[model samples]
Target: MACENMKRVQKEAINNWRDHLKRKLTGQSVGTKDWLSSIKQQQDFSRDDSIPPLTAPDGSVVTSHRGKAQVLAAHFSSKMTVPDPEREPPTVPVLTKASLGNITITTEEVLQQLQQAPAAGIASWGKRWQVTLAPDKIQAILISRRQDAVNWDQHAILLEGRKIHLQESVNILGVEFDSGLTYTSHVRKVAKDAAWKLSCIRLVAHLLDAQGFGTLYKSQVRYLMEYSPSHGPPAPVIPPPP
Candidate 1:
């Protein structure tokens, strides 16, 4: 009788757990324990591998996992070190207003300042923590409405004595930006990706009910659509005319 009672209790507990999960997935509030467990599961699902191998200062690639970790540690350590306030500031060429009313600095001065920046930042961290800025990864983009007026081929920015190549478009973070500064390309790409994800969800629609599908759509599809760059102010919304 005791064995039968225990089996009955176990079945009831399993049914209760399933009911709780269903409620939680359907936008209903769950217990603190359940909520925390769900968050942990999501975190585990989203966790990815460590940083990939990067090119060292001498141009040789650090392919080993340990080498990549060390590179990242040194780079971050240099960046995080506090600068000494008592230390004399590095001399940099001051920008002045030109005859055309635009503020300008000499190209030579700009190059000099760029060269000094890395050394100044890492000075506090010492030689062991020094990080080399990758020249090939550096991108320069001119933000001008007149594409024809801007001669990209003729102009180049030098960093660490190497000429930084100009690109028509570059992906900053996850968003794609072009010389024109239009979000059209980014929007199109995100839409295509979202469509693909939606197709995948549709394939498994038979296994999920409306609530489960809605939850999945919000977490995966809606997130992509809402993502925006943090650097700039958001676009203002225009109200309809009464």
Candidate 2:
């Protein structure tokens, strides 16, 4: 009789445990630990990208016909420092008309010309090393024309929200004399109120030249002149190009 009673008690206890588990799984507020442990476990899996490269038995270092596979592996391993989602990129500074230091050109006049007649602005002011203005919403320059004699094509880098788009065809004097002049495909756009002034475009251009991209790509211009909000349009170029 005692054994039978013990069996019944065991069955009841098992049933109660199942019910408790069901409640917890359904989020019915049964006592449990914080959800952070699960989240942390997921994050750990996402961050880990460690891998080892193959080494030859001779230990003198191996090089393949396609270059060193181990070298490429090591490079990728070094880049594992930044995870896919853990790191956030550094913020970019705003640009303003006042930031255009030492540039005496009338920005208001340029802005007006861009709004009224886009083609005229490029023809009159979009020369080599000229600080041209454009709508903030425009990011990349759309090359409507290209010169046949020039070795380069039209493609200007955009500063995103900072610069006005001079999508109209314009020439960029190469960093080196041998590089020759190339037409800008499109200009990169930037924020009107960037943290780094647009006036620094020349310096940036030099850096890009050092990286060899300048020869292949157009460097963005920095408008360092101060921009008076009251003097010109106030709207932040919203509704960026689709």
Candidate 3:
């Protein structure tokens, strides 16, 4: 009874979805405002990637390209620490064997500075080094056992004053990882993408010879399915090409 109810509900939902698409896409209703609006949205997506004019910090709308650039420049410049002119070294001597001297930097000073000012602390070592940590492009994942239902959402990992919240799964280079190390997300995604490619190739299968079809299958479809081949559910056994 439960399975029958589920099947009925699913059928109704699918029919409703099809009806919605039909109204939006086919017959006289295609002339409706919703259809036009949908087409316009698609056009906006396919084209028009131009950035809109930005408002400057000083209550001015920068319409020109050059003004917009200056606005962006000022915005990014505020994030950086200003260099002190007074701290400039007075020495003019170039490095040579005679200029080489013993290290003046103490280990304790380094440790103290690291602890005290983690965001901004630079006692020059052998050479000047710049902080390359971007405000964006940082991700973190937490891995744990499936039975462990402990929620650590309250805690956060901080680096360079930025909060990096933990994720159950994080994708890196198209591969997904989760807490349990099952890699279910990555395998499913790869499988779906491979299936789509195979279906597309199947449309034109009759045009290609067996050898050509095999080549395309090996290069495009098979390669995607074979990626990270050791993991997840195995692909179904398909009969050899006749």
Task: Provide the RMSD of all predictions against the true structure, rounded to 1 decimal.
Answer: 19.9, 25.5, 20.8
Better of 2 and 3 by lDDT: 3
1-242: candidate 1 lDDT, tens digit per residue: 99999999999987876665555645422333445566545444222333444887778888667787878888799789878958987898769755475777665664566447654454445445775666565666666665674455565455545666667778888778888888788888888988998999999999998777876776666556554333332232222232
TM-score of each predicted structure versus truth: 0.40, 0.17, 0.38
Candidate 1, position 73, lDDT: 88
Judged by TM-score, which candidate is best? 1
lDDT of 2: 0.39
Off by over 4 Å in 1: 1-129, 228-242
Give the per-residue Cα lDDT of candidate 2 at 96. Answer: 60
The candidate maximizing lDDT is 1
lDDT at 118, model 3:
37
The sequence of per-residue lDDT tens digits that candidate 3 reaches over residues 91-160 is 8777665755677865455445434543233222212565466545655665544335445555444565
Q: Kindly list the per-residue Cα lDDT of model 2 for residues 120-165, writing each as its tens digit.
A: 4453565555755555423323332433533222222223223343
Q: Which parts of model 2 have CA positions greater than 4 angstroms off?
A: 1-61, 65-67, 82-167, 173-242
